[model samples]
Target chain A: MPAHSFRLLSLGIGIVKLLRSSDWLIVPGVLLLAFFFVAPTVEIALSSIFDEGLTGKHFERFATKGAYVEVFRRTLVRSVWIGILCVLIGYPIAYFIVHRSLRTQVFLMLLILVPLWTSILIRTYAWMVVLGREGIVNNALIWLGLIDKPLRMMFTTGAVYVAMIQILLPIAVIACYSAMTEIDRTLPRAAKVLGASPWKAFRHVFLPLSLEGALTSFVIVFMLSMGFFITPALVGGRKDAMLANVIAHNVEQLNWGFASALALLLLVATIIVIVVVRLLANRFVGVRSVGMAP
Target chain B: MSRKMGNPGSILLTAYTVAAIVFLFFPILIVIPMSFSGERFLGFPPKTLGLRWYMNYFSDANWIELTLRSLRVGLGSSILASVLGTLTALALARSQIPFKKAITALFAAPVVVPTVIIALGVFIFAVRSRINDSELTLIAAHATIALPFVVMIVGAAARQVDPTYEKAARVLGAGPVKAFYYTTFRALMPAVISAAIFSFFVSFDELIIALFVMSENHTLPIRIWSDLRFELDPTIAAISTLLIVFTTAAMIVADRLRRRSARKPDA
Candidate 1:
């Protein structure tokens, strides 16, 4: 009995060793992230509170500031708007692609992806041309004898939305398209065959199935929008400032404590929103796999 | 199916889609022609057509210097990222390791987190650690950002190849390392190459983080950013056209590789 127990202990040790050896292959990547990624992130979060010792002064200052709170609220609301706009602009396009012939689908997909791979800075710059005072749109409008003065198109809220939507629409389209493709075509056909009109079949069967993907796109776009700094800074007026622009402004000023505090709060808020929305969505719609592409 | 193809609904959908595609691609490609404008500021119909902006970009010493620096940084960081990311992906393939889900999520977190937040955090770390503005610092910082892309692309590609090839190599008396090198690594080469190209652009195209961390090591994007804001030069349009071609070519290769792998049915 004693000999058998000793043999079992050695066997357990051998199994553990085998598993860990394979797992050990992941160490280099893990360590790289831990040191560079995790450490810096933890540093930022802890620095929010650390401030040369234990202190809640940064959070305290934030709690009292209405301006900071206003910025946060504006960020959230603007992001939600951007997300909804992307869905509206992208849905029909995505639905159209899914119904096309295979060759046309691939060709159209490449068209979307070309801009995706290109730099956002370039895209943003391109918008500056199209929407500038003396640019193409103004040129066309003037040629048509619509107005004498070029529209104050640049550096406006509408400019921000237009550029933001253009940048994000492809993402929403791809997300919705992938999910829409996975939906069994037979389900909608069955509804039509069972005395339902085409519109009714689509409304009841297809809409519910595709709603999950559109919602997923909305959530993703909103999450990305909340952190947008460049587009808002370049194209938006001072009032269109997002939370990320605030962080960049603070960092430039070398206000580490406040910037850290703002970053930590934004990170926590984003994670919480994602978790809560996902949970609520799962409960109402049932779990469905959604793919996000940008 | 035949009847459905000729319906009014389908026609309208096709029309709308074609229109949307035009909207999406128009602004992107217009820059190509705009790059040839002889005007100083952005204008659609030029008084003259020439390669003046392209000449300006080529002639300027600062532009040449900045381009070289960007190319160097992109190559350095991509080599680092692809090697490390591919290794990690190889290990992660067929992984039943404890906490694998948590580990994968951690690897993927960089993409989800906002660039501003990461840049801020990393800037704070650099300042505290007394790391100065240098190529090494930029490479490390950019590698961190690009690592997730490499891991996702290569890792997904690696999983498609069968493990039995490695076993077959072993049965034929090859050593473990040699077996993996010959079989799994060979299978993963296309993905690894694409991942490296993707990583290069990831470093090259980065702006916000480079804005924060870089000092004298001004990347092409940083140079373009300052120029766009301060000068409003059409030289940027020429540079942008060049960049678009490079990036589009890289993306085309990646897409072809992905489609080929998927359609191959076996590796």
Candidate 2:
């Protein structure tokens, strides 16, 4: 054999030897993800821009269309609000949970975890049951003689916000709780011992320590809220459709190119949000702890 | 700690937390009771209490079939994700793999990437490949989402097992495979099982992917979604209650397994 052929043969043999190594254990997973996850994602990105020969019409439509722009705006606005609300509600609960006895802590944590593990669809449905015309709140109002007729709470933006927040709150709590756990519980007490009031200690010492976790939870919730489908579709009015609902509608209508374009927009927006949040957090919050797991 | 009981601030905090907990569980609390309603329409303080909706769920062939379909998909995807995830975890934890962080992120990307994006991508991919609306395709899609959880859970467990045990097994005449299987794999079984259960639920509870992919065969969530869209009936409440119970039981089992494994001494 010639030198070049011998080199090629050696390379092929080297490949075989590498495959037989323990490192090959990851090959099946990488291949599976590549085929199903990476390939489809690339296909979407490609099809978005390359429908029958590199057309920009799909993206152009999204840019020019007021309705699509409105949906995108609403999705971002709602996601931001939901993220803020989750952190607001979740931070207190996490603080409360972290300060409890070990047994009480376990019990409190289970309360959060149970809801976390439950299906989002079911949780959203539960909101439907509670927020419907003849649902619990309306019924209770009438029974209390506060209203003569049922309130139309379902199929409204408020319903969407409430359901979304409820669904995403457990995640926020878990994130906050984990982060709070990392902070020395006695830090606040140490501040108190140094003559600061309890509120002051929490505001100055504990708050800063756990802020990163709160920010992380906010980002997670915001990203998830951006992709919400079942809740908004079930609870929101016709005007309240999010980007995901619109994408789903388009996909159902067999407008693959448009749907992929919208998906690309969502993907880009999510990445930007994550990256921006990390940069801001690092800059303002003074870099996350090195030991923190992503 | 001593001041907690009497302090006004602590009392206020306790009140707020209790209210928050109630808010967290509000839907679950309402749905369980409404599931027992005998009325055809959804109403709170259900006038006539009975098992009519529960009976409706059991007797409906469509619901039963969809439930079974969901189970099949869940089982298929969980098994696939668990096997692949376990191997990947072992490789990451035990081997000197290059680009470990990037590889881990690749596996974990499914969890962070919006499901809507994944659904669209999978839908387009399936249509292009002419594998749309198939159980196998659905399983693969579901497995992609479940892959992250399995990797995180099992990978964490794998890292905790002392490498010395496996090395000791190899030194004692066991082959590499046997060494791992006997020493490390056995120790990792609980984590694997729990991860599998969690992945099963991930598929079980998934809807967006199924909605995009399946038209002929509806999964349980798809059926529920349609019912929710068109009607507000107690049957959905019944189904929701059942799902809650099932999920709670599974969570308890998974938690127990995790705790038991956590308590085991490293060899």
Candidate 3:
């Protein structure tokens, strides 16, 4: 046979082999994931368990230490609160963008995305500048004669809330906006045709469809908040430390075992929350609508 | 009907949205003048206007070094991530892969999980492997962070590509490799480029892991953190303004490119 024919034969064989294989394409991807992601997580988990023969000291420390418990609780509370705040703050913006004319939606979308273009560090710095005692808000208030003295804002839980909500609100808005867009306008109109009031129509026909996207948005914000370190570290008071901050502290202090344990626990807790949130949202809000992209 | 008179909820919703936008964006907009301020402090409403701080950042050796280091890490990680991610996406999407959902979830987990936890895991593994916080280690870690995003974007792009062309080419006696390169690869280029641009931004904007992992070999964010920790400086404001311009331009261009390519009938 000619070389060309031989090449053709080999190509056909390769194709046959490829078709016969279960997941040849995923081999590279799976290997990469195993190496880069799954392996590291496994290592962290294994290290936490086996400092030397599978001791439970790391987990015990977390359970026994008041500091760890406080940090964990504070982290959960702060993250949940921030997630809620973002949802509360983001829902209206999402509603506006969804209901607006097409041209207006484009412009507002840019406004929403422009902040995301800037680095999170720069944005956080801007917050520091704005909320600092000698910063813009104080100066503006003083100039306007609102108070005799500057209000203490920086390094407070308020600062953390403000900065975090700012940082994560865009995500919530985008998520909710996309969700809201999926809702059929006719559903509300149908309710109106049935003698329901406009607001009642929206409340019954529209809100339920959007709830999944809103809940998913809330979960995303909460997940991201669980990992937040810089914003809280920079803005929050010393007592406002989150799990990420504590993990960073351990990593910095060379306590690898302890840090790994804390990280694993955080991961497990995040997974549980995500699952629980999904279940709850599905039960109440009807999660099938989430698949409908706005 | 008196419904319009009675229902003030729409008005309230509009007000809340405006307040939310202001709260989210007011600080970002306020920094423009702060960067231009000729004051010794970072106080709002500059006492005077001058380009001294911009000049200071441009001339400062430390800032220059940090910028270069970030560029090296960002660009390196971006290339590594885009290449590997595109390839993996192709393999996963186009290949006859069983457990496709599971594979996709594995790729996506890194993005969903807290970066702080990933950073800790990477930190421990690096320590064990004796890979200190050198530039190379940082790049590898960043590539890991960026990989998932690249996979997602590129995979979506790949789904839009017509597999019939590759099949046709193969029928025309083209080898599988040759057919893929000639037919499928060209179609995937726009997505590849967009994913590369996004991967670069991901590495460039990333800070959490950089903070925990690269303590000594400081990236720009770490430098800014340390500077802020010590004292107030207007130089950071100046640097941030420059970054904002670069990022905005890049995103706009990428968006345009995406739109142009998507509008292509052949695509």
Candidate 4:
């Protein structure tokens, strides 16, 4: 009996200790995050701005050089285009899945998800093989007597677009589909019952409700597109270069200072774009949930 | 049905679906026939059926070594990430950990950031530390990349797990550790396993960081990348086909387990 009482006392002490030490649990987690994330970000920022002494030479180089400025401009434009393209292509598919029966929706979702499970590099490589000069499209075109010479499909801006949009479309679809599923089906049905045309009901009810998800998806795809490297490098020409490719090249060349500057610039660009997307989404949709990217 | 909307929407949707499927699957599908080509170089309509490239990949010592090295790094990183990630998940889920949002965000940051950036950071850090780009260092880098996913998925699962079981065990005179081991850990087994499998695949398929970190020793993707850069070989196609088959098998197994758990009654 005495031993059992002692055990009970110890258990009581343990419970008190657990409650008292709740904050300790976060220490390791915080340390890990700080070491991996905060430290590296600080390092990059420092390396970019300072070279032996404090100087903005790296930023100056980006400003003075027309090539860097052009690359930045093109990267932004290309990413936005790709994001818009994904939304356009993905919305119908997302709508189809959301409107279908549960079983049918699951099947379609699986189809979309299976390809996403594979590596993006593998997917991009597949495109390179398909879009090459002697690839399937070229061979088919020749056989159909469409062109006298093989078309230059690979290593072009168009090729980059095709690959990036294909990779990012699934994300948009999934995002919009999840959001669409949340909206009450009866709301749209009520519009139909109130003498509204199907198209008009969809535009006024469904579109407005789903806009937030669509916008969030757009922001995510845009940010991801900005950071694209392997796809563009493998399939894009020199002119199709994004900021990510430039950062990668600098890293390879052992120019860490320049690489950090490029990386920090990319980060800043992404943050600004995300902020703009959120503000626009909030004003247009009047819903905060739709502004957040998954 | 409204003819005004139905016809055009259906046509557009069907056309887009077909085009998207063709865009997504054509490259993956074309590799199969090309893998069997008798010709030395890659061609769309492979001249003849032959097992030469498949034979070449199997016999090539360099390719075999790289494949084995990749397997080692992948397996090591997967195991490491899963253990640490799952532990961190438990702390986040069960404990009253402060700054929950910040912690979770940090864990998932690797997914958001471009991998090339991470590679550069690790490369710079490694260079300064004088750490050689060996298999161990590469595995560490890969583990860091995969850790966040394991934490996120496992934590989500853990949040749904019942606390009553552990509480009951503890009330029945079991120690905290013993109660957790008997009740909570068993309940979390399926999620932990699933998270481990996903982390494994993330490590296995990673290429960019491996490329940045390793030069003398190459992973499977690195090998294929280098081969593509030097020359377009049928052997690379064969290797890709093999990877597709293996990945599909692993995915099926994971999916089956998920389904089985979904069908099982709560414990």
Candidate 5:
């Protein structure tokens, strides 16, 4: 080949190598997230300290405020309960579906996915209707001669738990069902054949196998509940307020530093819980079966 | 394996599942009737059956405007996120990126963390950047959240199939762009479509970020939020029922498309 042709061929090779590498395609997307997502997160973490020099004034305000402290405590406490409630409600449903025919499992899972796709606001509003004084629950009770007047069931702590669990229960079920379905149906059967009772077979074999999924589901539900604002704000009483509500209130008040502080606190709390779960689950069991994206 | 309807435990399990399903869907069922109620207050089993609230939602100029605005935002963010996220997914599937795990984690970060934190973060950042309330900022903010879903759906779709056709074309000395243009893109088209639809819903349904980042441009959820805060009306219920039907259809379609594509072999 001529010298100029050789040069052209080499240039062509370099271009192919670059194209074959292909990872450059990720830059535009990553850059967008870097500026918008990661940068904002960093700004939030720093905002509590970055207001007019490095000061903890924002966090200091949070720490000093009894109301703020109370909201954080309530958020943490309620989230744990929501997680437990979800699992208690979810496990049996998942176990039932897991034991069903493949077609039934698919159909049942689709039923669960319907409410999952529905809007959170609509779900919250539904609870308001059902639990309201003149809502169906109250109306039914009145008609049954159980009560002379409508009961005030809306705007209570129980209302919050009910709605939140309803909103989040599908997630727990799907997670656990996915894991439960992966277990060999014969393991528990084999245990039963070996003289263990049916209950013991499940406890010794099925429960141990499925618990990791339940734990993962719990973590997810718990994390999401901690950040919940809409359901709590819409259906909850003043006492039912979570940290997310407090953060939103602060944001609305144009108190950016304080809002950022509250957001950071919630984020830290979420991270801590997740890390603890990961450590415990990784050490103890088959949490790798968790269906959540890593 | 021994589960039977006659067994006490099995019967209890059956009842619990039924109750759980009711609990899951009860709110949705309650609102459907309320939306048709001629009554002004929020009560189910309407005293009179009519589409008064539905008519109100459709006829009201403000509601229509917010609906159009939300569609625009949803489409805009969907396109941006789908393109960006699809590219990232393809990149991850085909080649090595530096700190790929960390990069993927960052992409997924928005979904895991609370939306309030993200809203607060973006709000504070926007204030500093002076793009706090712009439509562009809102689109960018939503796309960031929706990006992860696109990546997730498309990444899963991309990983399921062999990319040998593209690789083979490359080895046969087809230009890199031309080979991919001809091969992988065609194969991944169904998943790409699914991802776009999913991304649209993610942005369309988002409210918290919009509440913090948007001021003049009110989305549908924002409108609903304002109304719910000020008054308990049947119109909100009407909107909810309509959205529930629409979203359920979208999800079913998306799921079917996903299953079809997963079953298809290199088509």
Candidate 6:
């Protein structure tokens, strides 16, 4: 054989030897993700910018259009609000569960997980039943002579918040509960023994330790709320459309470039928020550790 | 420390927890009885209860077909995810591969990224490649999301497994593959099974990707979505009830398997 063919044959043998190695187990997964996940992400980013050979028009339209900007603003603001609500409600539940006996804790966690594992669609459907005009709440109010007409509870911002909060509350509780469990149970008792009142012991010791987990839960809920498509689309009114809803609509319209732009925006915003939160958390944790040092 | 049972603060906290639990479960509680409503409409208290809607669901061909489609997609994606994820886990836990952290992060990227964004990317890829409306494309898309769960669960299990057992097998004249298959693989079976179950549900319960990619055929969630959009009937309530039951059963099984695996002795 010629030298070129011999070199090619040697390279083929080397490649086969590499694949036969145990370390090459990652090859199949990496290939799958590279094709499906990384390639498509790159495709989306490229498509967003390279419509008819590298134009900024798609993003420009998003920035210039008042309605689109409003949708983006609403998505961010609503997600933050939902995140706050989840933390407010979920923190107490987490605290309660953590304070319970082991058996009780297990039972409570099972309750939380059952709903967490249920489909978002089913949960949203249940909300529709409860909040609809002829639904449970309105029926109860009318039966009690509280109102002559059925209240239009469905397809409103309040409905959206209620449904979203209920859907995400379990996640917040789980995050906080897991964090709280990691705390040394004797710390608060030690604080009390150090002459701090019960509230002060909780406030000064227990609260700070669990705060990181609560923040994590908030961030998770916020990120999820930003990309919420089904719950908002199903229960939310016209004015309550999120960015994900708009992207879905644009995709259906066969406006791939515009949809990709919106998706890129959502992805970037989520990443920025997560990175900022991580930095803040690291600093807070660093400060706490330093303060606790003897 | 336990709170004093007679304290006003303790009583208030108890009440608050009770109320929160009620709020969390209220929607789920409402769905079951509404599923049994004898009337055409969905009302609370579900007057004149019967299995009218459940019967409707059982007899409907479209619902049945979509359900079967969901099962096939779920099974296909879960098996793919489990196999790939197990191999990836073994590589990360046992091998001296470079950039281990980055590779693990890459495997987990799907979970962090929003489903809608991934759905759009995959949707565009499918349409551009002329692969939309195919089961394989949908299965691949579902597997992408399910990959994270399998990797996380099985990776944790693989890490806990002592390397000595496999190394001992290697020293006893077994081939590397046989060493792993006999020692580590047997120990990892329960975890892999649980992870696969979780992966199956991840795909089964998924909707946004299915909705975006599927045009001619529909998965169960897609069917539920359209029915929700175009109509409001007791049939959806029935379907929701059934899904809740299925999810609960699967969760129980997964939890039991996970616990068993956690309790297993080292090989």
TM-score of each: 0.93, 0.94, 0.90, 0.90, 0.92, 0.94
lDDT of 1 by residue, B24-58 (tens): 77777878899989877788766678899999999
- For the candidates in turn, chain A alone yields TM-scores of 0.89, 0.91, 0.89, 0.89, 0.89, 0.90
> Which DockQ-derived CAPRI band holds candidate 3?
medium
lDDT of 5 by residue, A65-154 (tens): 899999998898899889988988898899998887778888889989899998888788788888988899988898889999888888
Better of 4 and 5 by lDDT: 5
All candidates: DockQ: 0.66, 0.72, 0.49, 0.41, 0.68, 0.69
- Looking at model 2, give its docking quality level: medium
Local distance difference test, candidate 6: 0.89
Give per-residue lDDT, candidate 6, residue B15: 94
lDDT of 1 by residue, A1-294 (tens): 999999999889877885656556677788778866888899888989987799899888878999888888888888889999889888888888877777878888888788788888888888888888888889989999998899998889899998888888889889989889898988888988898987898887887889989889888898888888778877778888888888888887988889899988888888887888778888767533332111
lDDT per residue for candidate 5 within B111-227, as digits (tens), equals 898888888889888988899777788888899989998898888778876788888999999997889888888777888888888888888898999999887878899988887
Clashing pairs for predicted structure model 6, backbone only: none
Q: How many backbone clashes does candidate 1 have?
A: 0
Best by DockQ: 2
For candidate 3, lDDT tens digit of each residue in A1-294?
699999999899887887665346556556656665777798889979897798899999999999999999888888888888888878878987787777778688778887877878889889988998889999999999998799999899888888988899899999999898888877777889999987788776787778888898999999999888888888888887899889888887888889999999899888898899988877665444554336
Q: What is the TM-score of chain B alone in each candidate?
A: 0.94, 0.94, 0.88, 0.89, 0.92, 0.94
Better of 3 and 6 by DockQ: 6
State how far residue B118 of model 3 sits from its true place (Å). 0.9
List model 3 lDDT by residue over B1-267, tens digit each: 112423487678777777777777798888888999988987878899999899999999999999999999999989988888887888887775556778778778888989888887777677667786778878877888888878877777777788899989999999988998997888778777877888888888888778877768888878988898767789988988898889888877665555444444463
Minimal lDDT window, size 10, model 1 chain A:
A285-294
Q: Give the C-alpha lDDT of model 2.
A: 0.89
State the lDDT at A230 in candidate 2.
93
Q: What pairs collide in candidate 5?
A: none
User: Candidate 2, residues B1-267: lDDT per residue as tens digits?
Assistant: 334676888888789888888888888888999999988888888899999989999999999999999999999999999999999988898766668889988998998889999998998889889998899999999989999888888887887788898889889999988998998899889988998899899999999999999979889999898878988878999999999999999987887676666554644
**Model 5 / residue A19 / CA error / Å:** 5.0
Model 4 deviation from native, Cα RMSD in Å: 5.6
The pairs that clash in candidate 2 are none
